[model samples]
Target: MQDILYNLMSTEFENPWKTIRSRPIYDNPWIAVREEDVLKPNGAPGIYGVVSFKNKAIGIVPVDSEGYTYLVGQFRYTLNEYSWEIPEGGGPMNEAPLETAKRELEEETGLHAATWSELGRIHTSNSVTDEEGFLFLATDLTPGPSNPEDTEQLIIKRVSLKDAVAMVMRGEITDSLSIAGLLKAFMIVSSY
Candidate 1:
């Protein structure tokens, strides 16, 4: 078992897919879509479509001293539904994710944290999009007025961390970043 584990750990894998030709399918300020002619891992020829993001996604779970966390409610245009999620936004590639997280938290909920710890990172949608997300747990929060972007009409709610976790389990919180960030924060908070 140890040998097998060691061998697996030491194994180096090479890229299996080979790209032959590529061209842009679409482009916008936020994302660019490209289609590629490629050879699959099995050496079969195929076409792959990839969506490249112009920024990294940053998500923040802001929990106050009473173990309450904030959720941002907004109508997601793409999803065509109302969504409740943690404070999150896109940060440019050149900016530090922590700075983005702080900005998003303040912009959406008007909360600033004196303490911040990384929860984890996630690939938002690896199968099609090259969007990466950074998750953070923000604590020791100070509340002020929010300054949301013109495009955002947000509603903020404060709930206990346990309630937030319950929302995740009940599927009330459907945003990918929120689900991942809430569950992670719950686990981390519960362990202490």
Candidate 2:
């Protein structure tokens, strides 16, 4: 343990700096790219893939009163297929991460929670993406009326925790933060 701590302290956290072209390379709805040269940890210089989005959003692990996990079904535009995923929406720009999670949970599934706790924040796609995702756990839920947007055709469903994990493993659910939040929630609840 001491050696591990010493090794952790000895590792450099700084990345070598490089010159940038000082101009916007590409601008689009999802992200804007700026031309930047990066010096690698080994001192090699190259162009880096940088993406700037508005911000990441929040995902909630909604456990119902019956101890079942609430999941949402919707077609992902990118994936072009219907899949099971935890409800997630809004971002830091619209509201607080926790507030966003609450809003999204109510908007998509119409389940309101009396208690909420943030598990933590996740950095989604850190390799070439600049999105920070928030993870939340919701409990003491009561059913409410859903108000999905015109573009959304959401179907709320409750699943056993065991089956939910199995769905993810079977590739039936493919959302990133959903999988992460569900796994975390399952671990926490299962410990007791």
Candidate 3:
């Protein structure tokens, strides 16, 4: 695995597909859709539809000194199901991801932290979307009143980091960002 990753990182490659034409399919404040006509690497013509996001995504796991972390529960319209995830939201393209993480953490959980560390970065649904996400670990938390956005009706739950990892393993938390963030946090916290 290390060899493969090393080769991948050390190699320089160019895009194999040549774009022949492109057109917009949809547009909104949050997302824009475009369809492109391309010449494939195999020299065949193809069309690809891509969803572009206007903002980067940020997910935060606020862990107090007691090893307790917070989760936000809400109904996800696209999935038509309720999801339990770490405090997450969109950061404007021009904004810093850390600032976005701080704002989202406070807005969704009413928690402020004195220390922050980035867990990892992920691309959510790479095949269909160009949405990028950053995960954070927040410690030394102080709680206040939550100020969720108008579009959000959220339920906040506090759980041990271990329990949160179990929820991810049990498939109770399926959001990609949450699952990845929690699992990474579990590994980092367990080492200490």
Candidate 4:
């Protein structure tokens, strides 16, 4: 396997935010954004690009003690469709990624884990948007009551490890973050 960071070098960026244009991503009023950004790549200079996002969030593959995985179904305003995603949640503002993961896991799946291992973070379309989402593994879980937001109408469901992977292959679960965590977990679990 090729190392992803084999040739990577980075520097702290400041004042790289410049907006050429921005538009609402959805008609519902709270999600999505068509954003233009000016960034200093490799500390050379500033370049501008535009991209769209359905808001930023943390996604979790909530695993129970029984080795089951939980997913949540909710209507996504940007896609204007319902999706079955990993337990996903976000912050009030400027919240840590781990904090969001813990909160989202409990709210979406009604399950809290005694341990969480952060798989990593993913930025699917980082060219123009300023969003980086974290992915996590939830284990040692105990079930409780879901606490979805007032505007949220969510359904929680569980699938065995085998079935979860099958759902991804069947396009039944397409959320990128969830998919990433599952694939990573699969790589580790299947090796055993």
Question: Where does candidate 1 stray beyond 4 Å?
Answer: 1-10
- Give per-residue lDDT, candidate 2, residue 164: 92
Instruction: Write down the TM-score of every candidate.
Output: 0.95, 0.88, 0.96, 0.73
Clashing pairs in 4: none
Task: Report backbone clashes per prediction.
Answer: 0, 0, 0, 0
- State the lDDT of candidate 4 residue by residue for 15-47, as single tens digits: 645554545444433345443344444444343
What ranges in model 3 sit over 4 Å off?
A: 1-4
Stretches of model 4 off by over 4 angstroms after superposition: 1-56
What is the lDDT for 3 in model 4? 57
Ranking by TM-score: 3, 1, 2, 4
Worst 10 residues of 4 by lDDT: 28-37
Q: What is the lDDT of residue 19 in candidate 4?
A: 51
Task: Give the lowest summed-lDDT range of ten residues in model 1.
Answer: 103-112
lDDT of each residue in 1-192, candidate 2, tens digit only? 999999999998865566645467898666787767767667777877777777566899998766699899988898878978899875656667888888889999889999998888887788877888999989999999999889889888899877898888998888889889888888887886
Model 3 per-residue lDDT at 42: 96
